[model samples]
Target: MFSYCTDPDTLSGFSWLSCYLTTGKHMAFYRAFGTVLLLLAITAPTALAFGFCGARAARSQVAPLRWFGKIYIAIVRGVPDIAFFLFFVIALDQAFEWLRHQVKCPDWDEPIRQGNDFVVCQIAKMPLGNAPQWVHETYGFFLAILTFAIVFGAFAANILYGAMNTVPHAQMETAEAYGMNRKQAFWRVMVPQMWVYALPGLSNLWMVLIKATPLLFLLGVEDIVYWARELGGSKTARFSDYPHPDWRMWYFLALLVFYLGFTKVSEVVLDRLMTRLTRGQATMGGEAQRKAAA
Candidate 1:
């Protein structure tokens, strides 16, 4: 990255370190941190939306819808995350390609599964083989996002379903007494109040989501952990410009600090949010806030 980076052999101490850190690979390593943050930003809301739908479905008057929601929560929450991540990404990718193959390769007689291989026409590839590197990366990242959402959403649904029930039945009755319909009472009364109950669980889920970002590596997204291992692996002068001993421990220590700091910040923010949500409400948290104020 620097003009002096032309000669890594002569550079030493801080000078060598600066150039090494500013190399193209290092830039990518830096961007990997953003990738992790971006995953969290997008996945959190998407999962929440999925959870909301699932929670609502679980509580639906229609038995089929309620059953579907309960089954979704049960199955997803029951699965181990690593197993699900491994299975789901391949299954979802193949499902997409299979659907596309049916449309794009209708004339072909070959079955998609040839013992162990999933073969589809070139055109049916998720990101066509000829597509840019970014397209492939984006597609993988999208799969990662979807996988994260599905897994986390089920847990969120369970938390939300419980939270919804925790909201007093009398509150719903009061809304009905005021001539509001069931839907209106749910939206205007129960949903608004459930957040206070859900926040603690959601807060923990957010932290878990943060920790789970490393699983992106398994999905083939070049996440921070991937870059850390790549960059920190011992590089010899024979093969590369920046030759260094194995620094993975140091790299991982940096990651440890980053996650710790990120979670700490999340905790502070969630705590303040909890306090705000509880103020003037009827829960124990609200009561405590009131007592403290008095």
Candidate 2:
């Protein structure tokens, strides 16, 4: 804010605009962009790890493990993402609190589920009653990350499983012929080769994940979308120093430009990654690269 920001009545044009953009709420709006970026950075890798585990489990020699992985993939991929987001957050939150309640209040004679209310001991609360604002926000963000990971991870698992199968059987046989065991062949041969096949699907998944960041508002994270809607709504002179007509359309347009630009950058990066992964390999992409170089 500027020193002249103290008197909004006399401020006009660029002066008013600068002061408006530098308000406490506007600073929060700026920070919300970072929140979205951080969510993507953290969730992408965590989701990939989850998918890797699920994919490996689906292909496991043990029937129980394989069945578990198949069921997980089927259930998650089949469910609507919005429905999953709504249901899973509450379920996961309650599950955590319930576990904590059992440990922290072993002698309590009350049932956790009393009609519609799910009650827990104060100490068992996720952030606790006395916890600071950041702790509550962090807890909500953590839940959002987990929910996003579980949903996206299932789709990633399916993509990876198919990619693993697309690697030629002869490659595995050759590894075995060279005295490598199944695990060694998998890690050294199949896994390395699968990325070329998997990249396209994973790239699309990444885009979907980017679009899905708005769902953070549903989980109470006060993300970019939340801030945009809040700040863009019409504010009256009675409510605050700055008053304006509804500007939600402009705010949403800004969001549109942001997502479009972000996706464009992502496409460029993924293309380069695909090119690097395909070079010198046996796939069609590699074959094309070879011909181009020649």
lDDT of each: 0.93, 0.93
Which one is best on TM-score?
2
Error of 1 at 264 (Å): 0.9
lDDT, candidate 2, residue 30? 92
Per-model TM-score versus the true fold:
0.95, 0.97
For model 1, residues 28-147, the per-residue Cα lDDT tens digits are: 999999999999999999999999999999999999999999998898755588999998899899899999999988999988789978889999999898999989989999999999
Clashing pairs in model 2, backbone N/Cα/C closer than 3 A: none
After superposing candidate 2, which stretches have Cα over 4 Å from the reference?
Answer: none
**Pairs that collide, model 1:** none
lDDT of candidate 2 over 4-101, digit per residue (tens): 99999899999999999999999999999999999999999999989999999999999999999998889875567899999989999999999999
Candidate 2: lDDT of 26? Answer: 92
TM-score quality measure for candidate 1: 0.95
